[model samples]
Target: MYDIVIVGAGPAGATLARLIGSKYKVLLIDKRDMENENPKKIKNKCCGGLLAPDAQKMIAQLGLGIPKDILVNPQLFAVRTLDLNNNLERLYQRFYFNMDRDKFDQWLISIIPNEVDKRLNAYFKSFTEISGGYEISYIYNGQEILAKTKIIVGADGASSKIRKLIAEDISSPEKYISIQEWYECTEYTPYFTAIFDEEISDFYSWVIPKDNYLLLGSALRPREDTWNKYNLLKAKLIKLGFTFENKFKTEGAYINRPKRGSQLYGGKDNIALVGEAAGAISPSSAEGISYALKSSLYLAQSLEEGIDGFLDRYNQRIKGIRLNLLIKNLKSPAMYNPFLRQLAMKSGLQSIR
Candidate 1:
């Protein structure tokens, strides 16, 4: 039996595997094939692919260099915040990396140590507790497969299957569907754009420019009027000088916000939920990569202290990070009001200086 079985080979699972795979028998499973070179066949992460400064630091600490092929743009130097209601715009200087989400995920998977049992194209089915461990049922190559592990790390995304099995007592957080569309760009901008308009979306919208393409997306509350709102956003962008072809494709995924007191651990069980599965996403910016990597690091450190107090330690660390980020996002509500947004923007600029 393996020491740990990590589900979903995204940032969290892959980083965890890299950290402890040498010391423990680890099995990293992902539904996507890491060997696949075709971009069209890869899974879409539905991300704007902007890596905040915090995430860049984490990667630097891990001693990993970003592959050139994975990065779509060199670096974003500024952010353009647009107040749609007031027809005002403000620019803030910041440094962030813009990448292709699919390739970035693949790069993370590629760094996992060879000793870690990396299984791609393996679809996780279920988990059942057994003697001294859990039996992980999965489908591989049109056949059923089973693996035994002492601990289960649910590093899956927001809609985690492993979380459904373990976090039965935990209430789910507020969820929104993120819809994104990539378009061929006629002009390039050095700034990433964020737009706020309560009439279009209660959450937020972004326009991120890459090498030759621009990705526009918004997190929208699930409602019957979602399509209407999306169309309205499209029209608003058009008015702001964005053009899209009639035949572009769209991608979507679910993003979960962290609840105030949600459980990060599965009640003293051997299951540890990390990343978006445990609501480690930022409520303000909707950024998740940094949390995914940081939370997994915390989990690895906790597991290093043996199994007895690992769950408690992991929960404490994860919860501390979430609460801090939430508190930092306390200013999010002000973005809905034009006057408050302007004031907040000014305050933010002053603080940065």
Candidate 2:
């Protein structure tokens, strides 16, 4: 029996496991094997991999250390926004890190103590409510193992099995599908750039600079035709003075709107959800690494403080942030519009102060 059984070993699961490993018996399960660094093994995620300024603070609070090699000092010189005609409009905000998702996940998992049992290549089979809590069944190396636990956490990505099993009543809002391609540039740029296209109304392309590569991707609108958004964006990049020497990889995923309520703590009993499973990604930027880290820390804190107190504090802390972003999104739908995205970018730059 485990105190908490966390499904999925991404940023959220790994972080939570590390935080609670010392005091509680935690079982972290993932479909992938231990040290599985291949992005293609699972669904390739489309992300800029930009960590916000507050990410470091949250990481330290969780008592986890980031590995040195995975860190890229993307001292952002400027963020340039271009119109449909490739006209530069705004440039602001400097300094942010560019991280490789696989490397980042590896580093996060490395900090966890051995006491926390890590079950790799374990596919969650099903669950049933036991007398006190629940019994989770999974297949590991073709054998089934039933682990009884008092608490279960769904740190799984957007499509969470634990969430489906537990939060059957909770609903997820419409999701925006996004596509990304990582290109190894022949020449490196000093700044990060976002190009807005009037055609792709709700979507935008981003070029994040790393040591010797550029992370480029497009966030597609819900109903829009995604037929050739990647190729279109690649062509646009070439137009914007980016020479793509090698196409390293491409990935895509769905991002839920920010207005969706917390999908973390569900049921009146002992089940909890964190990270994308809980819909923690920011709707505006579709960035989730920071939120995953932050939410895991908060979940750990809540566990330490007892259930009731944790619920109250977690709701209070996250409600305002979600509400504010949702309201902002509703008031200015064009904030996502290509033409008006520059203004939104400018606003973000101003808020950095």
For this target, which candidate reaches the highest TM-score against the unseen true structure?
1
lDDT of 1 by residue, 250-335 (tens): 98999986546453443348888888888778777888898889988998899888877788888777767857666746756676
* Reference-based lDDT, residue 14, model 2: 92
Local distance difference test scores for all models = 0.82, 0.71
Instruction: Assess candidate 2 and give its lDDT.
Output: 0.71
**lDDT per residue as tens, model 2, 1-353:** 88889998888899889888998888999886646767456543456777666666667776656677887745565666666633436666655666766677767778888899998878988889998778999998899999999888888877777767767777774467777666776475777787777665454678787767777777777556675666777776687667776878777777655565553343335777777777777666566776788777777877887644455566556564466456545654555554555566546555333
At residue 263, what lDDT does model 1 achieve?
35
Q: Please report how far candidate 1 places residue 114 from its true position, in Å.
A: 0.8
All models, RMSD in angstroms:
2.2, 3.6
Candidate 2, residue 200: lDDT: 56
Candidate 1 lands at a TM-score of 0.93
Clashing pairs in 1: none
**How many residue pairs clash in each candidate at the backbone level?**
0, 2
